[model samples]
Target: MTTEMGNPRSRDIVLIILSNSIQRLTFLPVYHHATVVVMCCLWLQTKQSLFPIALVTNASVHVIMYGYYLLCVMGLLPKWKRLVTDCQIVQFVISFVVSVLMLYYNFTGFGCSGILGRCFNAVFNASLLTLFVNFHSEDYAKKKQG
Candidate 1:
């Protein structure tokens, strides 16, 4: 349902905000972080110390990503909202590429369990990126038109 101004309703806005926050704090991070830990475990089991270092670095990327997403949701820097919205495209690209790469590595180098973790990461990233793109287009794209 549309507001009188043809914008979304307050309820919709609140729901969107809550949904975004929930995805950031829970769904996205859980899979990404879990994959990192699982990969670290796999690396340890295989006596591959260098792999865990890469896994930690990969985790740091998600840290920056979710941290910024939370900042946007919190409106801690309202001035940056437009910037964040625009940057969402770039963020999605980065996340998608990373997930795909990790998935490829896990599939090639490890067994069933490692591949499963990477698959979770891939699915999470896909969902998160889809949300970002749809939100950006619905929110910002229409603003530009009118």
Candidate 2:
């Protein structure tokens, strides 16, 4: 049943443990690091098959974001700054959908793990979505108007 549902329990545990340790060593603001650590711990407790999907989506978006910043640093500012924001917004929307699905599956089936963590994740994503939308409106919308 676990294998059929895509929840490779042991592997997910190891991955979350490794990621948590690495995050501890990395230089992030204290609050951000703490938040990530908590999230990682929560994920460690989750048996949800969709956890990896969320992780991959978030990581992919960050890779693109950092790549965009790298281009700007190299004096090659891509004209696709708006695209980066668009991607972030899209990622959040996808995350919300995934969270909803997780909830549905949790109630309808054998239940998912790490639901608490998923709630925290949804709130965090919501805040980021709000901030990014405001940034887009203030930066891009103004340009279009004036």
- TM-score versus the correct structure, for each prediction: 0.43, 0.67
**In model 2, where do residues sit more than 4 Å from their true spots?**
1-37, 45-48
Per candidate, the number of residue pairs that clash is 0, 0
In order, what is each prediction's RMSD in angstroms? 11.7, 9.5
lDDT of 1 at 71: 82
lDDT of 1 by residue, 1-146 (tens): 12222322223334446767544353433443344444444445555423443445545654554567678668775444556545545655665686577666666884333454445455655776776677777878788899
Candidate 1 Cα deviation (angstroms), residue 1: 38
Instruction: List clashing residue pairs in candidate 1.
Output: none
lDDT of 2: 0.67
lDDT of the candidates, in the order given: 0.53, 0.67
Tell me the TM-score of model 2.
Answer: 0.67
Predicted candidate 1: what Cα RMSD to the true structure?
Answer: 11.7
lDDT value, residue 127 of candidate 2: 64
lDDT of 2 by residue, 4-79 (tens): 1243323333444675754433222233334555555666676545678877887787788778968976899799
lDDT of 1 at 36: 41
